[model samples]
Target: MGFGFVATQILAVSLPILLGWALNKLGIIGGDLDNRLSTLVLNVALPCSILASIDGAEALPDAGTLVLLMLATGVTYVIAIAVALVMAFLLRDTEDARVSYRFAIAFGNCGFIGLPVVGAILGAEAVLYAAIALIPANVILFAVGPLFFIDATADAGRPADRLRGVLASLKTPTLAASVAVLVLALAGVNRLGVAGQALGIVGQMATPLALLITGSSMAHYRPLEMLGNPRAYVAAAGRLLIVPLASLIAVNLFPLSPFLRAVIVLDGAMPVATLGALYCLKSGRDTKPMMQVTFLSVVFSVVTIPLVSLVL
Candidate 1:
């Protein structure tokens, strides 16, 4: 069953690459399709997806699930940070490389890849649990993640700047959607109603659009280059293997629901976040190692994710 689930996800992720390659070959790659698709996913589809998952629920998850989720999320981050520190210590040659390695290991592609895969395997309710898990992860990613890039020699900015960054990060559409859906669920909204049905119809597009964008972007890179980087290989091992194993242990200790446990483990097992390399680029840092790690981790997840599913 695990292998079957992994196979389905791999096929979903790969078909778009072929489509992207065909688009490139036919000179149809010059349009703003990437941006358009991205906007649709982030703004329209993802929010609807979240809402559709929760809008019909009689109530939010029990307090126990919420508490366990918070604890498990914290443990996941701690494990990620610990693994990253170990990697940095072992591979310490340059500050930039250290930062990139740590960042890549600490953040996985939970939103783009994890959501669809978990939704397919564990069902839509599992996806909702994953979204709840994402709140803290995103907070750490956008808030504390930038601090990793700041050099000790650089002047730390004012408190206002840090507060602003944190606030800005929390303003993401998906997060807003999560909050809204939870609110509606608590308020007992009927998801089978006209509004709910409309959202569900639009929400169905999120998974495909996300996978297609990932596949299309991947087509432009050379697999050989990604595979050859030693640092990237190290990061990939940590991201795909060590972190997931640790997350599995941590989640198991908490007595979460079976679906929640599966969601946490699978999300933890995912490849490097697609945006990690982009963040590196925007920060004027060396993006090669980050890109290599991202590509290699993703390439290898087809195997690792399935293995993780078996454990769950």
Candidate 2:
């Protein structure tokens, strides 16, 4: 795909966010509607979207490539976590902002944004590799991802309490869907049937709804403030530029194919996952830093992603 295609896809993705913000500013959409949309996204749309992506066993790479992709993904997250840790140390502000920085640094918008970008720019085959990359990424995203937001510092006496919280959080529909996709694929179940088609249709709502919710969340804050603070900009720099550039250099040390390498780097280049804002909404945390960082990173990614792609 050309840079025009890249710009168009990003515009398509961004318009809803703008609309959501506009509607909220005009008082057309209210909190009740935002709550319902958030619930629909987290509980229903996101899970369906995930399952619908892997419609059959054929959607995955071959077993050998699958192992290689899994390993590459593992290494990718390892690098991501390392980067996030460094960021966490650097951006030591409020616990909330720190968590936002750490979470956004560690995960990118792979499933929601990267899949379509890769499919359009690379090819169908590369899209499949991208899909499989999400197996490990989502597992981490939904599994341990929330822990970043949770306060393990509260009580020194109860590690068990924290463990239980982590376990309970894992029961979310998104994580369940991830496990289901893996099991179904490994079992060689190759047909989603009419139900699958229905799921695929509903699953399409995930990204737009996520963007809208994020925008609505942002609307709660002042428009000028939503542009973000200096620390938030630092996080944006890491999300949009620093993290992906590191991945592009780091992944070359691995034995991955060129396509997988490109996918890994491009995945890293995606803007902050809207999932961060979703989690903030769910837990009633201040979505300030996340929303700010997400907004800046995504808008900058229009140029940043294309530049990174040129290198690839």
Model 2 lDDT at residue 99: 85
Count clashes in each candidate, considering only residues at least 3 apart in sequence or on different chains.
0, 0
Off by over 4 Å in 1: 57-60, 188-192
Residue-level lDDT for 264 in candidate 2: 80
TM-score, candidate 1, is 0.91
RMSD in Å for model 1: 2.2
lDDT of 2 by residue, 223-242 (tens): 58867488888887888778
RMSD each, Å: 2.2, 3.6
Each prediction's TM-score versus the true structure: 0.91, 0.79
The global C-alpha lDDT for each of the candidates, from Candidate 1 onward, is 0.77, 0.75
Judge candidate 1 against the unseen true structure and give its global Cα lDDT, from 0 to 1.
0.77
Name the best candidate (by TM-score).
Answer: 1
Candidate 1: give the clashing pairs: none
Q: 160-198, model 1: which lDDT tens digit per residue?
A: 987897788689888887766555544556365788788
